[model samples]
Target: MILWGRPSSVNVQKVLWALSESAVPFDHHIVGGKYGGTDTATFKVMTPVPRVPVLQDGDLTLWESHAILRHLAGGVPPLADQWMEYTTSTLQPAFLQMFYELVRTAPADRTKDAEALKATFLAAVAPLEWQLRKTQWLGGDSFGMADIAAGAMMVRACDLCDPLSPQVARWYEQLQTRPAYRAVVMTSYEELRA
Candidate 1:
């Protein structure tokens, strides 16, 4: 199996974390972002939309991170589909907004309120935080696709949402102990800073 995308992308990080957790042997090729190549004829055939985290396995080529996660897991776990959808629709947008407002925007041009962005991200976190308070993992117990979907963002909240609530802090602690999380999700995102 081969995976293509730069690690700086949140979407790509999700797939990389999942693949690491599953212990799947796959080759990673850096493409997209500053690396370019997404517009190449080879990449066009692989990625219909010039996005990262594209996976090629056997004769099948899959784009979109969530679809890659589902395929890697063999099938969706309980509540995983729902949580993943919620993440993409809700949590992820807030995260992206926060990231862009803070990281991508130049300080001179950063007229957007940082507090408001954090609040938005926090509001999105409220529901997940409530659910997390009730269980060790998003999928109830064991770490699964659901955790991979949402958990990947927990580490990136250092500045935006530091000192996480009790349950989230504890859950993140567990994620930190995993070698895969450290190897993938915990890596520097400096490449994404603009």
Candidate 2:
């Protein structure tokens, strides 16, 4: 299997992190966003929407970060599967909205549009925070795909925003300890820095 996308992208990051956690071995091709070396003709055929994080496994081509995540989690635990859907369908939109505002708008404009977006994210994040307070991981106890989905976004938010909730901070710290999470993020960070 092969995955394509710039790792810095939250969507891309989610997929990469999940791949790292899975037992499967795959190649990661850095493309899209700033890397800018993707083959448009081939990419367009694979993904009609022209999004990042496209996965190719033999004859199967998959797009959308969340969908790719689900595909990767095929035989994983039930909680992992359930929370992956929940976070992708429910939590990620608000997070993405806030990210779009922050990255696309100027600081001055951030006050009006981005602040509203951020506030919406804060509201969205609260329930997850409450849920985490009760469970060690999003998928019950063990680290699984659901935790990868939520953790990918949670780590990105923590990077951009100051003073994340205590529960979130601890969770993020735990994620750092995971070799898979560290490998994906650090590899991406190093390549981006280069």
Q: What C-alpha lDDT do the candidate models reach, one value each?
A: 0.85, 0.74
TM-score of 1: 0.95
How far in Å is the alpha carbon of 88 misplaced in model 2? 2.5
TM-score of 2: 0.82
Per-residue CA lDDT of candidate 2, range 9-28, in tens?
77788888887776579888
Extract clashing residue pairs from model 2. none
Model 2 residue runs over 4 Å out of place are 37-39, 75-78, 108-114, 186-194
In model 1, which runs have C-alpha deviations exceeding 4 angstroms? Answer: none
Candidate with best lDDT: 1
TM-score of each: 0.95, 0.82
